[model samples]
Target: MRQGGIVGPFPSARERLGNGAISQSANDWEHRYRRTVIMSDTVATALVVGGIGNFFGARDAANWHEKWGILAFCTELLVLGALAVSRSWAPAVLGQGADEFRRLGRALFTATVVLALGGIALTSRNIKLWIFVAIPAIALVTMTARYLLRLRLHRQRKAGQCLRPVLAAGSPATVRDLINRTRKFPHLGWRVDAVCTTDGLGLDEDQLDGVPVVGRLADVAGHVRRDGYRVVAVTSDPYWSPHRLQRLAWNLEGSDAEMIVAPVLMEVAGPRLHVDAVLGIPLLRVSMPTFTGGRRAIKGVVDWMGAAILLLLFAPLMVSVALLVLMDSRGGAFYRQRRVGKKGREFTILKFRTMAAGAHGARGELAGRNEGAGLLFKLRRDPRVTRVGAVLRRYSIDELPQLFNVLTGSMSLVGPRPPLPEESAAYGPDIRRRLLVKPGLTGLWQISGRSDLPWEEAVRLDLRYVEDWSLALDAVILWKTLRAVLHGQGAY
Candidate 1:
């Protein structure tokens, strides 16, 4: 079918040509960003290697070239070589996700192992300095540099710059869902400029959400070739048969556009999902979520140690907050309430008192005023909240005492949000999956809009965490928690 006939009215040649500019601009920024990362990594590696070599080899300055310079040069080359081999500088991973840092870490590890093996093979004593200190320092500096660069990229994306132009193809409902998600999380860097539904139309005849309806699903590759979309996202739909999908992939070959097929299982991701080929057919294999393992043991150790250190560090602040709470409200310095934990166990969760003495008793009277989602009860301007409590809740200072809970093994530093007894009692079988792991002091719910998210969204995030829990994911949540606490957007 003709392009114009597939869609109602194709864009004029000038407009079609302008579409390529979006792809060009995307390529330009991505290229620049990757180059910048390469340069940063090079400089960071050099600085660490040079500084260590010079400081340690200062006594034999005359023989430094023979003794240290060669090793230093070799080390830098090895590090860079490892990064290239591991695809650390790939444009696709440069500015998003944990994969960029994960690759960088793997590269550094490879370089370190090679250096250690080389040192042992050569019987070199001085190599210990590089192994013990220099490589670690380089990792720190390079990771920090990459993080700063990512922050800059995210800022640009938030401002509607430096985003991949996407052409979504699916049923209208699924395509619209994809559109909503991209707009909600702009930092993921997708901007759906056009869409192609199964029928070459949407709920609205010409457009889906705000994106133009370009053509039918069959015309997706043609539109992508013509307009140069950076990403062609294929959401799940009955129209996409295995043979048709293969044809689509074949058509997308040689084009700059990357085709991403969304799987039927949406909530399960990360290390649990793997691709395998069985009987000449490619299959998406999902491993069961782990609840008990060495990793969980490490998580427990981290929770205990991390909570102890934080408790010591925040001791003075906690005391001050307690005193203020006592002064501002008719309650004890701390308030303890029973919350359901892992395996449906009940534990007393502690926090600084943030409400009047009889706030729980007064809950029924204000039931109609609840602004919370799901089983949560929230009030943005609850009269029962003490003056000091408002500030404490805003910065999440009231929950500082939860470190003791973490220290005592009643809660984790990161996991699902602890539900109240009534809430847990009301949980359906699917929601009961949250009880498989210990409740968290702060979780995906905390970092992802807290009380501001809808009940369903809150549950979805929790389930996702339960499904895809990992040490790396926990670290990310902890790091983001500081920013979320500082912003205090959804705190009631």
Candidate 2:
């Protein structure tokens, strides 16, 4: 079936899109279904929470004696509806989506603000502020429920359900890179079965990782028309002039397929994007990294505060682990190892001993069995681990003692993981930059597959963290650390 270009409806690519009729219609039902589920979920949560609040207040509700329940129900619906209206939720439906969570949480907060403003307007200022507590609490519960739903959906997506088939359009290398990236993060749920490149360019998608190439740049619309591909990701290239690109963009208009342009700038983080349009000329501005001076001060304060609190809270557990270590083997409960730290300073990083006493004293015995990266000796199932140590290491309980290092300013709550002195000694110049900041109890390395990561990837993640340090980013890394710690997939 032939379809007009730019301003016309989309044609079907594969029969998989359904019976060869692929307008927005094929995607519409799923879209509407998702939005409806999200709306219903939020609306239901608002009603239930509001109803419970109203029910408990009905006893002393002399003001609510005249058909108050109905009024309250309507008021709750009004609040929820208003909050939903303020957000852009059409992109996702059901219990969860990333945007859905962001908006729903914000909307719940807005509802609280609205209630506070409404209370202020009516002079209901006596202990009435307690009503607002339900706002955050209910939002948390609702968002948590949505998170569970997202987890389920992600699992389903991983099993190959509910996905968009994409035609990656770029140079073979870029297309493969994009495919590899998207494949690595399957939560985005895109399945690329086709590839297309710029018209008659030397860059062919034929050799691009076995995905079939349908056509080239100028024939993109025609290719989509014939094959029924609904998404085309165009990598940035110099050949397409501004006008030609705009024409290409215009040509894909009103189709089921969406055009995504991937720019060449890889170092730009998502948070750094800003746009300005002066007389219709748009500018894309990138924010500079904010990891020095004042930001460093805030990071220091958080590191100290977090370490102090964690240490205080875990004192009894730490003591128990110490006793276990002393009972299991010999020597002290704590182990001190020289590690490379900030500015290449050598520090004795602390940990609850998870190895037999003098495990390294027998270093010559295990030198041939060095089961780790080039310099660092790590073993998945090391016989050196004491019985009690296995349990401690499994859940990362052994590292909790390192909080002391953090408190003494010898380490940080979130930064690059400290390297062993031997590991540091073998470093290329670039690897030494991992010592630019104090080491962390948990870091990008710990969160990103921990000991399972390749030496190169470990270095890459550390460098990335150093170049893009922020307190907010630190907080995120800490949060991810909790999840990683609990999962403990790669710790041992």
Candidate 3:
């Protein structure tokens, strides 16, 4: 039982999700994502300790041996289930933006909350504060610190530059955008060595931003084989029909070069994506997002448990923060505003007051100077920030008050970033998909360069996470969010 739980029942690593054609390495963010192992072992060890205690008291249940055995078996299943769910969540979100990462974290937190709440509900015993506090604390500490290490790995990848090199294949325009996006994200770990058009290169062969156009689509396999290119990125180029693509796949087979297709869907995620092998033809299918049955139950449990634990541990700090906020500014210490949440529900989102009392009313004053991209309003160096507020915002201490939001069922420990009404208002119907899950205090957007991201990319990241919700992904995001907090990147 113990062994199986530690090793969650899931497909081995290779059967895992593919990295797509993104050439960025996550060396900088690997430590945080990798730390899930440490947490799993920690959880496993805790269970083992519990079992040992039960063993000594075996005489109490000696007359009913199966009762003890059944309990142990259930515990094992819970742990294993947790471990497997988290696996999909973790890697999928590693080093990217918030959406995938937050979904993963929320999933895990949801599971833990469900387990704790159900245990309390079924048994008339009081909820154990120590267990609630200790388990999550250990997991978060290990998980968060591990996230810090991942950032270092990202830095290392950029330093040694030992990234997998790729040859981009597509139409000139699509290839151009793909190459640009890859260059923008250095940590994605892929180095574009060359570009290949379906026909002979029409684009600047002299330089596609320094790398030359090596050959046409006809030469892709041979060029990759000879140049030792590791990946073949297929963009949404019209020239490559299904017949041509199948042939390319056939030719690229049995080679080390991985063939990747970049689906054109904006903001669509893994769960929304389905591949149906029908009548020998594999068709890609996508489904709408749903949060019913086990999903909602899991989320509710997570919100309560995560909030309770946070409130208990940070009660002292919360007071001190309130006092500081009162002294620092002439406004309420805790700021609450309506934001869009899961399924278009409006809830009061909480934040540490970083602006003056009339910050909301004074929106017109800052409109002309708005520097934030898309619908989100931001300025790299905003003048609205008070001296005390700047400090609070820098370390994200101001957001601590959201523990209440999490507790009150208005938010989650991790999920797509909650968007302000104004931001949501500006969102195209497609972008509003971010509202599929509850907003989080810290998320993929917050951690993955925060305000530095373009508005479109941020929206895309959020939707991706909603579709690929998993426990492991959330753990990975939680870890990364910690590092982003420490570094204070893109934080105003």
Best by lDDT: 1
Best by TM-score: 1
lDDT of 2 at 485: 85
Ten-residue stretch with the least lDDT total in model 1: 1-10
The count of backbone overlaps in candidate 1 is 0
Candidate 2: segments with Cα more than 4 A from true spot: 1-33, 36-44, 51-114, 126-132, 199-207, 225-228, 236-238, 278-281, 292-316, 338-348, 361-368, 374-376, 404-413, 421-439, 465-483
Evaluate model 2: give its TM-score: 0.78
How many angstroms is residue 306 displaced in model 3 relative to the true structure, after the best TM-score fit? Answer: 0.9
* Candidate 1 local lDDT, 226-268, one digit each (tens): 7888899999889999999999999999988999999866678
Candidate 1 is scored at a TM of 0.91
Which pairs clash (backbone N, Cα, C closer than 3 Å) in model 2? 12-228, 13-227, 13-228, 34-93, 35-93, 38-94, 199-217, 230-257
State which candidate, 2 or 3, has the greater TM-score: 2
Question: Model 3 segments beyond 4 Å from truth?
Answer: 1-152, 265-267, 379-384
Candidate 3: C-alpha lDDT: 0.66
lDDT by residue for model 3 over 1-492, one digit each (tens)? 111111212211122233422222222223334455446445653555355436532334433322444444444455446655666335444445444445444545655676576556655132242235434543454345434544554574555343456788888788888778777776775667688887756466545666678788778877766555567898887777889889889988876677888888654654567789999998888776666667667767977897898789988988888888899879888888888888888888777788877877777888888888787778766777788889888888888888888888888888888877767777788787778787877677886788888887787777767777655556566756776898888888
Which residue ranges in model 1 land beyond 4 Å of their true spot?
1-19, 54-71, 123-128
